[model samples]
Target: MSLGAERRHIRDVTAWQPRVPGVVEVFHAHYTEYAYPMHVHDAWTLLVVDDGAVRYDLDRHEHGTPHGTVTLLPPHVPHNGEPVTEAGFRKRVLYLEPGALDTSLIGAAVDEPDLRDPLLRRRVGQLHTALAHPGDELEAESRLVLVRERLRHHLRPRPVRQPHPDERPLARRLRELLDERTAQGVTLGEAAALVHAHPAHLVRAFSTAFGIAPHQYLMSRRVEHARRLLLAGQPPGEVAALSGFYDQAHLTRHFKRWVGVPPGRYARTSASLT
Candidate 1:
């Protein structure tokens, strides 16, 4: 088999680790002829092909990326990818932490790695978009929660369990924790552990009690903190660090969404008033 042409045309490949919880890595690739060798990953592989298609073998069974589908390759499973056409393929992948999905579901994933669900495909696409932008961690995290839920739904269908009796207390505790760590913030997993609840349940409790998602609530609080810092004349970049944002862009995005102007302009205008 000729590998030279394929090797030379392997052009686009990008990978990074975002700060969002439950995600280990994000990768995007475009290739016309490149093929992936049989390999195993320690994390769960959630993949979607944006253009073209991919043919792969998981656990000795052949699989392909059909149009409007999401593929979930379980951890420790061996897989390989090949181009399905002369046009090659473009794909975005999320490597989820092992804990993101239960290990027992590995069997189900290996049995049916390719899922034909339009909602899952769309949600995965939205997740990739969120991951690509630096200031969109909150959005990314929120989308990830939904994506995980959808994946779990496919791998193992379960009945909806009723909320526990202490749901209100759990929400109140989460709110208090958020108040105490507004500047620092907290991951849903960490908050759940501290509050003695499951991560999904914790999100439900908080949102039900406050009518806002945890990430949205946190971003709003950070924006409020940034406002105070801007009024005190702190630079936007510096205020971002003090306000618990990933960077100035992150701070500015939320600040403008919550406030009416950018941090610099807001600071200047407030100074004029004083």
Candidate 2:
């Protein structure tokens, strides 16, 4: 199936049951007029907004999410959400148990250490696939292996960084743009324009100063906003759009690839905890 069709199938199946024990349930829901209040979950809650904008409060911080965004909530973090307008909202939720990851695999060993890192999109994809198709021990083992390899690769040490006082002006401008437009999605060229430099020059400077490219930094900011919305109870489709993704499917593709589960499943599992 195409990625879009596959995601729809996954979303449909996820809404059926709570899925595996200790593995948590994945599901989707729409809030026409109702909304979820502040609540906490015993399991990790990951999600994406699929439709309208959802407003959320996480640890006293508030966020407004549109569509095509992914959200991640660590276990037990107090959060709540509601629709921003009368249109209501739609979203996906996934619940994940502590230690549910297969530590026997090398990638699984490092999963926890970097769970909060925004760059783990691929790891999330593997976990989602494993949960989507639960079966024999051998298949599970293979999934674990894939997770291990990915984690191992991620955990490898990289060269240390040195502070650059010279890049402060550019860096500050980049950060401001990220903070203001994270939901809108900022491109490298656009970011560079603010600093009166070429995209390539800005990218090189950003890498040397922050150890990552400009676009990666922007994605991290977007993901952070998405997380805040999920905790507040925004739907996946809305979150995706707000986070600069093209659509629900686009957001799901990246969210599952990064966070290990679809957005709707994350929200449903989170709601169930309350």
Candidate 3:
């Protein structure tokens, strides 16, 4: 939703628990005039404001979330928030499990909860987008690990080195796994365990080797399978299930993305020529 024009003061909130591990919940909100009373949560609150801003008191200290800022409220901290301007605020949030970040860093997070990292802000937004999709668990999990690592870096600075280690074998093994399970996709965690590599590393290896991410590779496989099924005169609804899509809508989305036409249109158009 765009914040280009002023929107009415109606509380809008979306919350869900994704299948990805370590993330307890995803919460998104847009409020014009509402104010939050002092409360505490059992999970760590990671927030980013997309429009307007938020002014909050965390642990008796005042903090504000301006645009381009990533906010972290440690678990068990008492906080209260309200809009920073008349325009109110639109924000995306992630509630991570307590263990996602070590307890030792809680003090650092409480000391300085707001981070002004542009890359981190962008990655968090992408992570939210990935989490919104139902069948993109692997992409969500991959982004989550990177976001978590970046959060840790802010709490405790570390040197990041880019390595070019050979990972072709690992990448090939992952391709084989994807090919075998195209009808029923595998989770990043499962692929990592089966391939004996770290989840993030596995994703990196696959992308580096194949020029596409693992989830994208699987989706392309499914889309191609759907194409073949459609050419065989199979109905779009049945092709969706047979090709490992969540439903017909999901099939149409990926199919159109790859083929430049929806399943029904493609089937009918090709048949008309024959």
**TM agreement with the true structure for every prediction:** 0.55, 0.42, 0.55
Winner on TM-score (2 vs 3): 3
Going through the candidates in the order shown, the clash numbers are: 0, 46, 0
Give per-residue CA lDDT, model 3, range 1-274, as digits (tens).
6564436556555555677888876767677766765545557889999999999887567999877999998875556688888778889888888898888887788788999999999899999998888888899999989998999888963232222458878987998899899899999999999999999999999766644677877886687567657766789999999999999999998775554456887677435533
Best by lDDT: 3
State candidate 3's TM-score. 0.55
In model 3, residue pairs whose N, Cα or C atoms come closer than 3 Å (at least 3 residues apart or on different chains), thus clashing, are: none
**Tens-digit lDDT string for candidate 2 (1-274):** 7986544333221342223454455555665454554544445555655678778765445765544444555543345677787666676666656454333332222122223333444445545555555363355446545543544454444332333878756765775677688677677777778778888877777655554455655655455456546645789888888778789887776555434467777656656544
Candidate 1, residue 138: the lDDT equals 100
Flag regions of model 3 displaced more than 4 Å: 1-7, 157-274
Find the 10 residues in a row with the least total lDDT in model 1. 157-166
Per-residue lDDT for 65-115 in model 1, tens only? 988889998874556788899888988888898899988788788788899
lDDT of 2: 0.56
